[model samples]
Target: MNLFNDAQSRSDSFTLDTAIISTRVYLVLLCISTGILISYTALTPHMSTIIIKNPPKKTYENLLKEYQSTLECPCSKIAILYGSFVSLSPVYHQVCSSPFISDEWIISSQGKSFTTKDSKAIQSFFIILKVYCSLTEKTVSDAWNIFSQSVLITSHTISNDELTIRTTDSLNQFESKTATEFKRISSLIQSYVATMFSILESNVQFAPYQSVNNNSSVNFKLMPTTQGNNCSCALNNECLQIITYPGVTIYDIGVIYTVPT
Candidate 1:
C-alpha cells in the first residue's frame, strides 16, 4: 500500500509541472503581441507627419514659379496701387495713352467728380509723362518740349466746366509726323519700365542730360483748368495738356527752378 501511494504522488507532481509550463508560454505570447501593437501605433503617426511636411518637391517649385509671373508687369501693379476712389462720370473722356503706355499702367481712376477735376488731370499727365520721358531717346527737357509742341494743344474756353484739348495725331494716324515721334518715344518707354521693374534682371545704363539753368528752361507743375484758374502755357506747343473730364484741360505746371551752379 505504501508503494501504491508513492506512484500516485509522482503522477500528481508531473501534472502540476505541465500546467506551470503552459501558463509561462501563454504569458510570453501575450507580451510579444502587446509590444508589436505598441510599435505599430507609434510609428504610423510619425510616418504620416513626415509625408505631410515634405510633400512632393515638384509641387513646391511650381507654386513659387506662378507667384513670380504674376508680378512680372510693374505699371499695371502701380496703377492699381495708386487707384482713385471717384464715382466716375460717363462724361469722362480723354486721349487713350494705352498705345504708348502699356495696358498695365492703365488703372481704374478713383474719386472722379467735377470738384477733383484738375487734380485728376494733373495726376494723369504726371504719370504718363514720367513713364513716357523715362523711355525716350530725347532728354527730359527736349522730350517735354517736343511732346508739348507736337502732341498736346490746350485752348481757353468761355465755359467754366469745359476746356479745349486736341491731340495732333489721332489714334489712327500712326504714320503721321507726330505719330512717328510717338512710336520712337514708346520704344524707350518700354525699355525703361522693364529696367526699373527688374524685368530684364540685368544692369541698365540710363541716358544722360545736361543741367539747365532756371532762366533758360522753366520748371512747371501742371495746373488743372478750373473756374478762374489763370494758369496758362505761354507757348502752347511746349507743354502737355491732360484731361480731367471729356473736354477739360490743364498745362505742364510752371514752377521756379533754382539751378545749382
Candidate 2:
C-alpha cells in the first residue's frame, strides 16, 4: 500500500511538469507571432507611402512615345480674349492730323480774291478726309469685335508646336483680310471725292498756293509719282509725305494725297 501511494505521487509530479513545458512552448510561439505581425504592420504603410510619393517623372521624349499626338498640356489661361493675344492698330493718313486741316489755316486762306469757291472745295475735301480717318478706325474696331466673337479656339489644351502654328495662321489671315478691305474702302473714297470735285477737268485747279512772305502765286503741279522715298501710294494708300511750310513759321506737315485714277 505504501509503494502504490509513492508511485501515484511520482506520476502526478511528472504530469504537472509536462503541462508547464507545453504552456511555456505555446507562450514563446505566441510572442514570436505577435512581433512578426507588429513588424509587418509598421513597415507596410511606410513602404507603400514611399512608392506613392516618389513616382518616376517622365521626359518629353518618353511621353511623346507613349501618347503620341493625343498628348495635350493644360493652358494657364483657359479663356483669353482675342485682344490679349492679337491687337489691331490702324495707322491713319498724316494729313488728317496736320495744321492744314485746322480752323486757323482755313480762316487765314479765306482772305484771297479767288478763295470763295476754292475755299469751300478745300474745306469739303478736308472734311471728307477727316471723316474717312475716323470712320476707318471705328469700322476696323467693330470688325475686330465681330471677328473675335467668331474666333473659336478649340485648342484649350494643345501641344506647343501645334498651338504656335495655329496662332501664326490666324494672325496672317486677319492681317491679309483687313489690309484688302482697307484698300477697297480707300479706292471707293478716292473715286467719290474725284467725281464730286470734277478733278479730271484741265483748267479747274483744286488747291491754289499763294506764298504769304514772297507774295508769289505758285501753280500746283500734277505729280506723276504720288509718293517719294521708294514708297508707292498704289501699294499702301495710307502712305504719308512730309510737306514743309516755310513762311511765318517753318511747319513740317505730314500729308497724304490720294490721286484719282
Candidate 3:
C-alpha cells in the first residue's frame, strides 16, 4: 500500500509541472504578439490634413475711398498730391510694371507712441499697401493717391477712430513741380518710405537726368525682383495668408519696369 501511494504522488507532481510550463509558454507567445502589433503601428504613417484661412480682399479703390471719408480729427485733412510726369523710359516702365514695395518700418514721430497692438495692425496694413503699390500699374500720380490714402487709413485707424489728417491744399504747390522740382519732391517721398520701410528705397534705382538732352528725364526701375511663391509677403507672426483667386494675375516685383510716356 505504501509503494502504490508513492507512485501516485509522483504522477500527480509531474502533471502539475506540465501545466505550469504550458502556461509560461502561452504567456511568452502573448507578449511576442503584443510587441509585434506595437512595432507595426509605430512603423505606419497616418495621413494628416491642413486648412488655411485668408483675409478679405483689399483693393486700391476701396482703401482710397475709406481714407477719403470725412474724419473728425482737427489736425488731419485729406488732399491729393501728384508727382511730375515720369518720362517715357521703357526700361523704367518695365520695372514699374513689376510688383515691388518698400519693406522698411521706421516709426515716425506720430508712430512712436502707438500701442503694441496698434503698431502691429498698422504694420500689417502697410505691408498690404506696399505689395499693392508694387503690383498695380500706377503712375507717380496713382502711387501718390494710394500712398496718401494709406496714410489717412493708418492715421485714423491708429487714432482709435477719433481723427485723421489728410493732405489738404497746403501741399498742392509741393506736388506740381518742373522735372527738377519734382525730382526733389520725389526724393523726399522716397526718403520717407525708406525711413519707414527699408524695402522700396533700395529697389528703386534712379537714372539721374542728363542736362545734355531735354528728353532726358529722371527714370527709375525696381530691382531684386522675384516671382511666384517667392513673392509671398507676410509677417512671421501673422496667421493671415493671401490667395490669388483663379484668373487673377499675381503681380511680382523686380521682374520688369516700364518708363511712363
Candidate 4:
C-alpha cells in the first residue's frame, strides 16, 4: 500500500506540470492571435477611425507654412553661425579671401626680407605659414599639426584667440622629444609645399602699414629712406629707428615689422 501511494503521488505531480505547460502555450498563442487581428485592422483603410487620428487640416497647413518659411530664411544668417554669420555673407565681400583667413599667415619672400633682422619667433611662425600656403588645403592641415608641435621648442606664444602655439609635456622627455620631432618633420614637409606654391602664386602678405605719413602714404622701411623725403610728406626718423631685439628670436622682430609693398 505504501509503494502504490508513492506512485500515485508522482502521477499527480506529473499531471499538474503538464497542465501548467499547456496553459502557458495557450496564453502565448492567444497573444499572437490578438496581435495579428490588430495588424489586420490597422491595414484596412475604410476603418479610418483606428489609424487616421484626424489632425485638423487647417492646423496641418499652418504647420507646413511654418516649415516652408523656416527653410526660406536667409541661409547666410542661419548657417555656420559661431560669431561669424555675416563675415561669410555672399551679399558682401570679405576684406581678405576665405583661404587667407587661415590660422596661419603666408609671408612671401618679398615680405620676409622686410623682417630679415626680425624676431626668431615671428620669423619661425612665418616660415610655418609659408609652408602651409604651398600645399593643398588637406596638406596644409597635416603640416599645421606638425609645425604646431615644433614651434613650441622655443616657447608657446599666446596672442589671445588669434594664435596659441603649444608643446607636449615638459615633465617627460618622451613627450618633449615627440613634440620637437613632430615639428621638425612638419617643417620639412611644409617647406616643399611653400616652395611649390611660391611658383604658382605669391600668397604671402606683409604686415599692415605701421606708418602713414602726412601725405597718406605708408612707410614700410625700417629706416627713413631718402625717397620718402622727396615723395608726399609722411613719417620721420622716430618712426624708422633701429629696433632692439635682445632675448627675442629673429622671427619675433619680423612679426612686428611692416611688410614692404
Task: Please list the Cα RMSD from the true structure of every candidate, rounded to 1 decimal place.
Answer: 24.9, 16.6, 29.7, 22.6
Ranking by lDDT: 2, 4, 3, 1
lDDT of each: 0.38, 0.57, 0.40, 0.41
Relative to the unseen true structure, what is the C-alpha lDDT of residue 10 in candidate 1, on a scale of 0 to 100? 56
The C-alpha TM-scores of every prediction are 0.17, 0.45, 0.17, 0.17
Off by over 4 Å in 1: 1-11, 46-261
Winner of 2 and 3 under lDDT: 2
lDDT of 2 at 250: 29
| Number of backbone-clashing residue pairs for each candidate, in the order shown | 18, 0, 33, 17
Report lDDT (Cα) of residue 133, candidate 1: 41
Candidate 1 residue-wise lDDT at 132: 48
lDDT value, residue 236 of candidate 3: 20
For residues 160-260, write the lDDT of model 2, one tens digit per residue.
Answer: 57767977787778777877887898789876765564442222333554455476555564433344676544344444444222232224334433322
Error of 1 at 148 (Å): 41
Number of the top-ranking candidate, with lDDT as the measure: 2
Off by over 4 Å in 3: 1-11, 54-261
Candidate 4 wrongly placed segments (more than 4 Å):
1-100, 103-170, 201-261
Candidate 2 clashing pairs, residues 3+ apart or interchain:
none
Model 1, global lDDT: 0.38
Please give the RMSD of candidate 4 to the true structure: 22.6
Worst 10 residues of 4 by lDDT: 81-90
What is the per-residue lDDT of model 1 for residues 49-125, given as tens digits with 9 covering 90 to 100?
11224434465455435544332211212221101211212221122232223343334233333234344343344
